[model samples]
Structures are given as C-alpha cells and as structure tokens.
Target: MAFGKWVKQCFESVVDPDKENEVAELTQLLQAGIKERKRSFVLAEVLQDRVYKQRHLDQARNGIYQRYLARAWADGRVQESELEILSWVSKCLDIPPQTLRAINLETARPKFAEALAKAMDDGIISDLEAAELTEIARAGGLSLPNFVEKFFHIEGEQFLRGIFAAAIADDHSAVDVLEQLVATAAKLGLSRKVVVEAIRPQAVQYIEHVLADAKEDDILTSQEESTIRQLIETFELPIAVQVYIDEELRELRLLTDIKNGKLPSIAAPPGVNLKAGELMHYHGDAVWQFLRLLKSGPDITEHPGVLAITDSRLIFRSLTRSGAFGFGTIVAHDSSRGVIEVQRQAKPVQRFICHDQSRIPAAIFLSALRMANQTLTSQDDKRRSRHIPRDIRQRVWQRYSGRCAECNAGEYLEFDHIVPVAKGGSNSDVNVQLLCRNCNLKKSDKI
Candidate 1:
C-alpha cells in the first residue's frame, strides 16, 4: 500500500518493450521522491495506470472529435472550428499536426470526391456545380499551407475571380470582403501591399464604382459615410491615391467621421451579460478598441480588441467580426510562480504595442491560475458518454440564455462541449452551451 510500491508496480505493468529510457526516468523519479520523503507529485500520477492513461486520453480525443464531425455533418460539411482544432488537439495529444490532418483528410476525402464528381457531371463547375464545389473545398481540408514556400495558385484563377466577384459585387459587402481577402492572403505569406497590387488595376475602379453606388442624388448619405469609414482604414493604397480618395470623399462630405474613427457602439442587447459570469475583478475602463500583439505574423502587426480580464480567463476578444483578428488567452508556463506564457496559435509569442503591453493582466491571471490545476486537462477522458443528448444541448442552450458562454453575442450559434467531447464529456444539456463560431474558436476544447 506504500506509494513507492504502487509506483514500482505500475512501472512494471507498462507493456512497452522499447521504453527503457522512460523506465529509467520513472525509477529515478521514484527513488528521488522516496529519498526526499515526498509522498507523491503530479508526475507520479501518470505511472499509476498506463493503460487507463493512454486509453482515457485516446477516448477523450476521439469522443470530442466524433462530436465535432457529427455536428459538422449536420451543418452539411466540415467547419473552421473542426479544422482549427486539428492543430491544438494534436499538440495536446503529442501527435503531429500533419498526422491529425492526414487522418481528417482520409475520412473527409471520399464524400467530397463524390460531390466533386457530381459537380463535374456537367463537364464544368458551372452554376449547377457551384454549391457542390464549395462543399468539396470545405471537406477537402487540404492544400492550404502554413507558410508559402513559393507563390501558390492551386485554387485556380477562376476560383479566385469567383471569390472576388461574389465578395465584391455588393457595394456594402465589398468593404468587408477586401479585409477578409487581405487577411487570408496574409496567411499565404502575401503582404497587404502585394495583395492590393495584385488587384491594383481594379481596386481604384471598384472603389469609385462602389462610392458612386453609395451616393444618393450626388450627395453621400450617412450610410455612405459609414461605408467610407469602413473602407478608409486600408493603408495599402499609395499616398497619392489615398490623397485623391480623401479629397473625393471630402467633396462628398464623407471624410471627417472616417478620419476621426467614429464607430458603432459595442453595446449589446440590454439584458445580455457582456462580461464573464464571475470574477468581475477588473475595474479598468474597457477601451473600445486597442491593439494586441499579433499572434503569428509581422512584429508590427496587431489585432484590435478590448482586453478582458475575468474570473474564467484573460482573453483578447477582437473587434473584428467573429473575432477574426484576436489572439490567445494568457496562460502560465508551468507551476513556477510568476513564470507565465501567452497561449497563441500559428506563431510564437511576440511583443504587442507598448501601450497595450502595459495593460496585460498577467499578474492576476497567473495568480488565479496558480491556485487552480497547473495543467488544464480536458474532462472527456473519463466521462460515461461522449455523445451529448439533444435534449441536453437544448437545455444548456437555454441555460446560457442562447448566447455564447464566452462572448455573449451573435445568433449563428454552435453547441460546444464545455469539457470537450473528446475529453469524455457527455452530450447532456448540462455539458453544452451555444456559442457563436468566433467565441467557439476563442474557447476551443483543446488545450
């Protein structure tokens, strides 16, 4: 019944014949624990039952993934959440991201292949093929690289044109679409200037055309002014071109508000809780928009959002729609006090703007985290069922007031397992809450 005996016995039960290195480490730790009169440590727990440890973790990963797949299926295809988690889930499980992506591609490949075949039944991806093609692309889950070795155009010029036309045809929609394309191109290692240049010929013409569409009786209305404001911040234009645009906008009386940064208020519905449920400890003014260090891009790059420090987490919710421009929560490096780390994806942690860096809630965030479990392990490993019952999803949805448990906004909601289905959490209504896609990304079930 002694701790040392249990540790030795569990060590012997490990079936790996090629784990002499691990065995040596285990024995060393056990000996040191006994010599130091330390009864147990967190590392000692993993030796208790190797099978349970591995099996539980595997089931946790699989269960949550299955839940994602099922939901993705119900939504008619794979989703961004399903795609993004492939990296984090693999990291936590200590598997290669490429391997997880390969597995995903394997399972998703055939259904999409058949869809693609149907789309090409007419010999071309015409209007009859457009919907199918979109589904196929979503399901393929391949071809996009983390970095650009060379400029890649596998998506085809027509595909790009289709995207551009679909996104830009509407005058109001063009402003948002341009931002999105810029962001996406950035992921492909294209600078904003490069992206603007690629479309330079049309950029001016489209800007003028859209502006004309916005004018009413040759006078820009309030709606047109707002549109101009949204379009005005893109700095990729040449100084001279920007000057011309500014002069034109001024003539149309749309320059002042755009230049001064007049923006729509962030106030949500009256009863919606805009803050986290508990730990309203932070008393600082929630600056409407400040820049955070960009997660994985240029050093000068920053995401605009209000910095939030609350009971549950310290998160930077981006000002961009669906949190399209945010970074990760501030997490601790380990159990070491005062040694904290920012959990970011895509890129290594970089410095933020000086003003924003001064506002990081690292001290309080780390203080709270130190008191809790050092490892934010998922609960899915030991749950009774990974499948959440529909009734439970409905119940949890109502419990959260039909808003994202993370960010109380948006109506296009998805059910997220609080403990993550892969970690063995149930599909019971108590286990799930509705979150908009943006909040879901912010609150991914992965570590």
Candidate 2:
C-alpha cells in the first residue's frame, strides 16, 4: 500500500456511523476540528516511537560492549584506544558511567587472560603483532582520546598501515593512498613533521596520487588544504587550491575584491520560505550517506541535497545541478541509545550519533530545532535578523572550489554556520562556509 495511505489508515480506527457523526459534530462546534484532527494524525511521532524499543536499546549497548572487549583484549590487554571507546560509550549511552569504565579493567580478566594462555604456546605481542592489534582496535571503532591522539602515532607508519589495511590495501604502488593517508593522519593526530617525513619517502606516489585525486574530485577540501599546508608552507602553492589563490585565502588569490557586508545569509532551499533569523543551531562533524528519507511509502529514492540544522528545523538543501528531491525542515529528539531520532512524516527518521565530545547532544539540538520550526506559523516569523552577515561566503567557497569544506567533495555543497545560529552566532557569510553534504554532517557544530 502507498505510505501516505497506510499512514492515514494507521491513524484511523473503524468507527460506527454514530461515533463518526459524533466526532464530526464535535469538531464542527470548535470550528478548528479538522486542524486539530490533522495534528493528532502526525506520523513522525507514531513511527519513531514504534521503531526503537527498550530491548533494542539494551541489546545495542551489550553488543558494542562485547565488541569493545574483543578489540581491547586483542592486544593481550586493554589499551588507551579501547579505554577511550568505553568513555565515549559512557557519555553516549544512558548507562551509569562507572559501568562502562569498569569494562576496561574487566576485559583483561576473561578474554585477555584466555588469549594470553593460548598465545603462550608461541610468544608475546611482537611489533608486527602489536601493530596488527592496533589495527584491530582502530577497526573496532576506536575513539582515540586526546592524550593518545598524537602520542599514539609514535609508531606512526606501522600503526598507519594497520589502519590502512582495514580500509584499503597497504601497497605503496600509487598516490591513491592519499585518501587513507590523510584519514590516518587526521585520526592519529600525526604531527606535521611526521606526516611530511612519511609522505616524503613515498613522495613519488603521494604527489602523483594527490594530483590524481584532486583532478578526480576537481578541488581540494579545506581539510585537504589544511593537511597540504602542513606539508608545505602557506602562500607557497602556485597552482592554487583551485583558482590558484596565493593570499591566505581566495579573495587575495583571485585578487578579486569582496563586498565586505554584502555576503548572503543562511539560505533556505527552493520551495522553502524562510523567516529572517529563523535558522539557528550548532552541529559537528558526522558521517552521512544518501538515505531515501522514507521507508513505508513508495521509496522516495534519494534526495539530491544535503540536510542542515536550524534553530527550529532539520533543513534539506537540494542540489543546484540536477536531482528533483524536495527540501525543508522538522525538529524533535530522543537520545535513548547514543542516537537522536527526528520524526518527519513520510520521511524516514533521521538518526545521528552523539558518541564523542565532538558531538552535541541530539536532544539539545532537536529541542531548539522544534521551537524554531514552530516559528513558521507563529509570531516568531516577525523576528528581525538576529544573525549578522560576515560576508565571507564567496571568499571561503573560492578557497575550496564549491566543494565540501572538509572532504572537498563536489556534491551536495552546503552552507554551514561556522558558529551555529543557536550558539548565538550570525547567519552572515563570514560565519559560514560551503561544506559537502558528508563533511557538514560529520563536523561538530560545537567543536
């Protein structure tokens, strides 16, 4: 059955003729009966509540906890990486923090102890073995703690190979290794000196691969630029990040002037009507994929734009190139098991992970989004531009070539408020940059 029809039926119960007439007459008396009935038929809330149950939440915790222990014990002992995941899971889940902490010490006893016994038949964690163990820890969702971030890369190359192994081959034949290399550098907080040294030895392939990847994507992401500058000095690249800018950023590079205060403000996708200052909220780096955004209805397929968080809604900005996907926003939240569920009628619930300090509480953001979305029909629409204009959008976009500010991806380029509107920042160009759908979603609005 069609989703909209099925949804309509879910809210409808078979009523006797007398009951139906009575409901109709009562609504007529109030004069807003139909409106009231529509509100009660909301499908987002009903489906969200049913999709996740207490059992599912508890099971999810148990599962991750077990996987955490296995990865921790892989090294014959729980190390910092495993310890950090426990800490993150603590903050993410509703369980007592102590329970999660205790797992660190406990993982060693049963699993590590047994593994030690089995390994005794041979030997101990050799560098190769320890390196492999590290790789396993990374694969099993290691959330490296700050203290461990840089120091953890002390065994940089080896550990990097371990990480790369999980994602792709560790072969040194080409620069396509650029993707894995940058990802590892960012994750382990590899020092610039270390990062340069590592790439220098592999420069032939690294440079070749970087150029290839750049051409493939057509631009370097802000994150990619940051990584590149770490390798070479700023104002040093002649070819430009894209437009060949030599100044700190594009305006200087293009030698083009920026109309300081004339930058564009937070934009709503086509078909969306925005009340000035209605969009405000913070977010962080997060992983995202093309979700159909609907489950029950005839598959709505994929939408062409990216989604954003405003003070009162989850906004969808469709792509400008092609793709007829629709766009708009809705808001709400529930953090039952490290995930926030956003209820949207006919749209599959949007789930975001909040397992790291880099992530803001979904509930907090959702509440603000809900209140902001309500402004569409409320006195809130009269709000003046509470957000200021930095007028730096064009400058930043030029820096990255209309790609995601982080990954430099071309599709779903979106404007992200550097400091979220909810955090009391402006909707101006200076406070925003163009981010690809994926990077914008992964970045923390708070961080």
Candidate 3:
C-alpha cells in the first residue's frame, strides 16, 4: 500500500474510551479518539476507578499511545505543547517508557521524514520550517539531527554542501558569506574537514579564473600578483594548485623582463658575426622575401635563411645572399602575418618572415631593437617628438571607441604609430591609432 494511504488509515482508526464498556472490549475499541477528543480525563478515570486484569491494561496502554501519536500528528505537525501532554498522559496511564517510545516511532517517524523532505524541497530550511522540525522531533522524543539521521545518515553532509555552494556563489571572499557558511555547518554538526571538502571545487574554479586573467597580458603586474597571492592565502589553496600558479607567474616575470630590455644574451649562430660588444639577442630559422618592381608586376622572390638580431643590427644570412642593417641606418620596421619588414635609408624594405610567426622571436627582436634605438636617441642632440600629449591620447581613445583598428577587439589595446616612430612617425593625432595586443604585435612585433 502507498505510504500516504497508510498514514490516512492510521489517523482514521481512532478509538473512543467513553463508548467502550466491557473491560475486555475496552482494549480493542480504545484507540486514537482519547487524544483527538481531548478526553484524557475519561481515560484516567477508566484506568483508576474500574478494575481490569493486568494483561488487559497492558494491551490498553499500547492502544492509548498509538491514538495519542495519531492525534498529535493529525495536522501534519506535532507541537512542543503536545509533546508535554503526551508525557503527562504516559505517566498517568503508567505506560512503560520503552513501550511509549516504540509506539511514537512506529506512528510518527514516517510522517516526520515526509515533512522534512518537503521543508528541504527548495534546498533551504527557513526559520518556520526549523521551528516546525524541532517541534516534530520533540514529539518523537528525538533531537533534530538524531531524528534526521534515523531517515538518512548523510543528510547533514548534503546540507553543508548546499549551504557552502550558495554562500560562495557571488563573492567567495565576502566575510559575511564565510561566517554564514561556518555557522551553518556548525549548526548541522559538521566538522571543518567536511566543510572544506564541500567548498573545494568552487574554490579551485575561482582561483583558475583569477590566474587566467592575470596571464592574459603576457605579464603579471605587481597589483595582479598581489591580488592572486591574497586569494591563495584567503582560500588556503593546496600545494598542487599553488604549483601551477607559481609556474605561470614565473613565465610572466620572464616576459616582463624581456619587455623591459633585461633580455639575456644567447650564443650567436654559425654564419652570424657580432661586432665589438654586440650581444646576440635572437637567432632562428626564417624565410626572407625580396620584392622587385618589374613591368609585368611587382615580382617577389623567397629565400630560406637564418635571421639574427644583435644589440646593434638585424642580420640575415642565406647561401645565395647575406645582408645586415645597423639600427642607426634603419628608418622603420613593421610586421604582418609572419613577416618583419625593415625599411632602411635609401634602400628597399627587407621582409624577414619567421617560422610559424611565433611571438617569442618577435618579442625578443622588438625588445633588442627598442633598446638600441633608445641608445641612439640619447646620444644624438636632435630632439625627437615621441610622447603623445594627454589631449591627443584622449581624442584617439574616444575616436576608436577604445578598440583595436585591425580586429575591432577591445582588450589589451595600445596606442600605435600609423608610421612608426623609428620611421619618423609623429605623436600628432593624425598618426596615432588604437590596436589590440594581437594587432599591435602583428603590426610592429611589440608585446
């Protein structure tokens, strides 16, 4: 039979003591009606004034407890006052403590379990539901956790998981949310280990998101590093996760050093010769494209070679031809796709394309070129205008809607020279444009 149907039948089988006459008849007819009708006085008189056999009284005691349980739970909840009344009724009728408990559990345990399920339907237990659950537990003569444990041993763990998840949903570092999580877990009688395990998955995801954002620019700023460090401490992240974050930070620091012109020198390639004090910054396999003007069209020729950037110049050596351009002689350089195009004074632009157009070579080459140019500018007395004034910067940002010109991307944007400063580009509004990291890197090999 369905559980609901059985509960309904149990409540309907109430027996009344006022109508039962025979001392033998009383045991069978006396069921739930005594408590439902508030006739505990009549039951007391029947037991005290009338003479009945001991076995009959024992049987009658069981009937009275069942009827009292049915009446107390008739409205789908048992109140604290009803529990007190049940205790008084049991004492007056001299029902054994074990017998009374057995009757209550048999009749009320299923009802309490069903009610608890309903209260947790929305994954929350409200104040009213908590009070009601407490009352129902008392009616069954059990504590709240003990009462729930009777139905499901892991209910407290499930509650902790749900509470922790909801608390950290918005801001994991929120003090109030943390306090609430700890308090709720304690209330459920859960340990610190269980609470930590429940929240670990979310904590890992949050840390990963923050780390990804920090690495997006290819350099970790001091502020970003500080924020990530604070998060790790706040969450008490495990060593396994900390190791990954540390590796990313190390790579970012290297990139930061490269951009700041602290790039380390490497051994020169076989065909490359360094001038006095010229340290090789980069050397790799590359394809060099030479453009020639002809009647039919602009003829293009490709040659495979090794391209090297030193502290002084860019050198490309091929089996057929070799050329070198000192930083002082160069007018401008630009990059697109996989090619770096250098225009020298009174010479055709030389385009060197690196393998796969990797950003590492591009970054090293740009950093070396920039540092060399800075040295030239500082040694020369001819003042060059390179700094963009505040007004021009504001105007350019507004005109571009703070997005890249090439890709329409909005992140990692930079102010670029339409004609590079190395090529005599000005800081005027007409020459400045916005480009995202990828577009800027493609245009000038700038990280």
Clashes of each: 9, 25, 2
Ranking by lDDT: 3, 1, 2
Question: CA lDDT of each candidate?
Answer: 0.45, 0.42, 0.66
Least accurate stretch of 10 residues (summed lDDT) in model 3? 377-386
How well does each candidate superpose onto the true structure, as a TM-score?
0.24, 0.19, 0.47
Give lDDT tens digits, candidate 1, residues 1-447. Answer: 999998976876586443555444544544354346433333335345543334434444444444545556665566667656544434433444565565666565566555544543432345435544444454545442321222234332233334555455443365666666666554434566655555544445455543433221223567755555555455365677677666556644522232222212233322224444344322222222222455674343445444443444444444452131221243312211111234345445432221222112333343344333335433212222444454565456447755667777533355666776545666666666666655665564233
Which candidate gets the maximum TM-score versus the true structure?
3
Itemize residue pairs with steric clashes in candidate 3. Answer: 15-32, 32-67
TM-score of 2: 0.19
Task: Please give the TM-score that candidate 3 achieves against the real structure.
Answer: 0.47
Superior candidate under TM-score, 1 versus 3: 3
Candidate 2's C-alpha runs over 4 A off are: 1-230, 234-264, 267-271, 280-309, 315-447
Residue-wise C-alpha lDDT for candidate 2, range 1-447, written one tens digit per residue: 999988765565353334445434433332232235433433233234333334334445545555646765665555666667555544434445565545543443344234323422232234444344344344333433232342344445554444433322233423344444554454444554455455443342233233324322234455544444543442122344423222223321111111111222355555555556665343333333233534574332333344444554544444442211212333323332124444445656555543332113343343454343444432223122332222354455455655666776654454566776545667665676766545665665323
Cα lDDT for residue 23, model 2? 39
Q: Residue 215 deviation, candidate 3, in Å?
A: 4.1
